[model samples]
Target: MAADKPTAEAVAEQLARLREDYQARLPAELAALTALAAGFGGAESDRARLDELHHRLHKLAGSGGTFGFTALSARTRTLEQQSKQWLAGSLDEVEAQAWQSLAAEVAALGETLNKVSPPQAPAILSARDSLTSDETVQIWLVEDDASLAEQLRRQLESFGYTVRHFMQIGDAEAAAHTQRPDMLIMDILFPQQGENATEVLALRPILRALGCPLLFMSSCDDFESRARVARLGAAGYFLKPLDVPRLVNRMTQILDQLRAPPQRVLIVDDDVALAAHYRLVLLAAGMEAEALHEPQAIIETVAAFRPELVLMDLHMPNYSGPELAGVIRQHERWASLPIVYLSAETDLDQQIEAMGRGADDFLTKPISDAQLVAAVRARVDRARQLDAQITRDSLTGLLKHASIKEALEITVTQARRHGKPVTVAMLDIDHFKSVNDTYGHAAGDVVISSVAMLLRQCLRMSDIIGRYGGEEFVAVLPECAGGDAQMLMEDIRRRFAAIAFSYSGQAFSCTLSAGLASTAQYPEFSGAELLVVADEALYAAKRGGRNQIRTASPHPLQEADRP
Candidate 1:
């Protein structure tokens, strides 16, 4: 046969598809291989089975090498040789066991190889062509017309615009609770089909609450409809049958105008002279700074300015540094607020105590300007890590339920404050209890730990993964909408299902189901409400079937949204 020729794009797509397919089949393949090897007999019947396995290994080695899966090829080649030896009667019982062990090892390597294959750069490049780093524009299409909604979806997808669509304002409000898209394209004359007008009007407060860039789209651009959209805080108005190209350009311009550099930092100290001194140091370091003398007003000042970092003195009479730290920690909203003690508490014990009491770091009074700046930078970085760990699960290193809730709250607050997008997902292992019962708790541990590790490897570091007790895990993805979060979780679900766990000479496989909900569809709900909705979706996943992800009902009542 002539040497097969495939374009790089074709090969890459084929490889990507193969990786996806192989991940789906990997668990079963490994189980079969493990059982065959472990149960191998010393007669001709066993030889026939061994020959079949050898042929499979040979085929995998050859094809894997051709497909640039070098590690898979190498491991398969080793297995192929071992199988040959076992079949040739040149292998003793020890050699047979070794061959079986090698087969299992090769199977594991094959799973890894599937993930390591480089994703198709061309596909990413093509996707990127539709989006620009400079653009921050997004659109929401609220239409009962499914055709129009889908048409707009395709058009926006082609333009690389983030788009969300809903038939009812209730659904839209629910999505906006977590995600605040850049714009809203609404149908003015919604055919009030058994939906309450008050409920519909309630969506306006939710949209306004999100503070997102908004636009209205309606077939009937009547004065009443325009007036309603205006009251909803819309920025632009457009009639249905929108000019896609013109809309894109206009959105790009609006987003460009909104982009700006980072904000300034201000440190308030009761010592007036010291405050001014710190301000000058911060200014020299190229940051905007202000000094305030009143310790009591730090909270109000910070709330207004929203500075990224704060430094406080420990020795203040009325508001001690530790007390101030406690206040900041209690703010539930800014619990992760970085507070560094800048007092002259030189005692080693005091420094440790301050840190233990929520102070990110402590510096002796009369600190150097250089030391101040460096300490601020270092503590800010550490605060981020600690924030992550506090929310993450200890056993699986995923997010804990509390952390997931915190993240969702932050996302909702941010969207209501700055119009950013957010997504929440709940994951649960399928029939997990059965695994524990059949394989023993130790094997169950392996499965849970393995799944957690795989989830960490699969998701971006920016994404938050948390254990929600039992076999359930939750992920909070900032800057992502429901569709994208669902896809990512599904990929994780599939990869997790394909992984095999071996213990006590037996091998088993596992699967997961996930529920995805985003703020894009429901903009008015709180973070707590969004989590309930996501959890409800998880229940749907469990009900529909295991090993799948389900999107929650867009208009689920608040009380009914929870499990």
Candidate 2:
């Protein structure tokens, strides 16, 4: 209880500040609403002003209850409904007495703003730790082979992983009681059988207690051995004569899948205070939230922020939520983007009408912080899943060709704007057709996916890799120089060549060649131009040798044929 006092006090102070801020701005907002109401004529030409007035009242109704002004919120909501009705009605239908009554109610809005106690703190305001990306990945390696264990420890450490080597399962279990690693790798067999030499069944409890992904490695490639590991829910299985790079690649993939990027949400509302409140709530719940006050900037902001879900206010001065949603849907790329209306509108018919205009759903105003976070998270998660299915390659799970090219162009433009260098690599598996001809298409897929995993494991997480088409792939490395990128590709090419592929009891290996083109070398080239140059260099690499890397020559002067 004592430990929670500081957090509670902090939340109280923040709520107090918000209440004060809302109170200070209330007089001006109320005055503006009153002026709009007084000047309303209910004529065709006065439609814009009526819309503005309605929007202001809508905001007041929504935010007033949020700050504990329940009475004020209710009054404004009735006025908002009246204004909406006027907008829907013709000049003949709107009577003079009705206009006067609405104006009077609007003018008396200030009287409803009498001081009230601030609302109680929301659950979202409780203190929570932030996740940092720089934390080292902890890996526990439990193997009876001391030499292999030390070698693996060294290799993982070189890749910036913290490795703990335990020669016995009992030793590893003892360490797990004190601290758990992010992932665990262990062997299935122990020659020195004893109480410490726990069998597969005995290891289940330790694995459950650690609560992390497990990767099993063994020399035996028998179906029984693999099936036994499968039942334990191991993240991966690696055969002996282990390729360390491939092992690290599997580890990277598992960690990446476990720690997904935070969900992105865009909050669009005319009420600055209310938008800020929602942003704070989402942020506390470990989401990335941004607010857009100017409705006209919706398209531009959405493009830059690339939010998974949009939380939009139902009414605004210039554009209603439905109109803006229509604008977003006009672009084919954003057609499926989620647009949820958050407003004080309680009419079922009106809500359904708004949804028909392009919104996916509607949430009533005065929503609690917890409800807002949960709703946003759920929507964003589903949006991400749908997006991945649409844009990613079916086999490699990387961006498809068209999507990757679009991403590269955007990355290049951003890098150029920041005056940073960007590099693009064109990679192709050497003798890929021969492998398919000799082995089979299924074997070809295994080789392709292996290269994809290697690329994902070897490249910096910030780099983007995609399967271009067939045996070819593309990688975009932001802020990487040509020489550095070439060196990286060379390392990957060698490691890939060392990987053995088995087909029908025959062991075969494949190699890859890569071409590099950097902004440092061709400063004036666009992403498309860079790709053309990289393709040229890729052919050059093949000409030089089947398994090597080549950098593009400088752009030709006055390239009349360049696309």
lDDT of 2 by residue, 1-563 (tens): 46598899998999989999998898778866765665544345456557878898999999999988887898899889878987887744664455656765786665454324333232321210011212356798989999988877765664556788888887888766435678989887887855222254455486556768888888888888777777777888898777655676678678876656567789999899999999989866766677999988988988877778999998888888888899999999998899998988566776788878889988888899989988888888788778788898877778899988998999899889879899999999999999999999988887887777777767765688899999999999988886788888888887787666677678798889888888898888899999998998888788877699888867565232232
TM-score for candidate 1: 0.38
Per-residue CA lDDT of model 1 for 246-291, tens digit only, reads: 4544554465344321224557577888889988787555444556
Where is the poorest 10-residue window by lDDT in model 1? 128-137
Alpha-carbon local distance difference test for all models: 0.65, 0.78
Specify the highest-TM-score model's number.
2
Query: Against the hidden reference, what TM-scores do the models get?
Result: 0.38, 0.58
The regions of model 2 sitting more than 4 angstroms off are 1-138, 145-164, 173-181, 188-212, 216-253, 267-284, 290-306, 312-335, 341-348, 362-375, 410-420, 554-563
- Pairs of residues clashing in candidate 2: none
Model 1 residue 269 CA deviation (Å) reads 5.4
Deviation of model 2 at 522, angstroms? 3.5
True-vs-predicted CA distance for residue 462, candidate 2, Å:
3.3
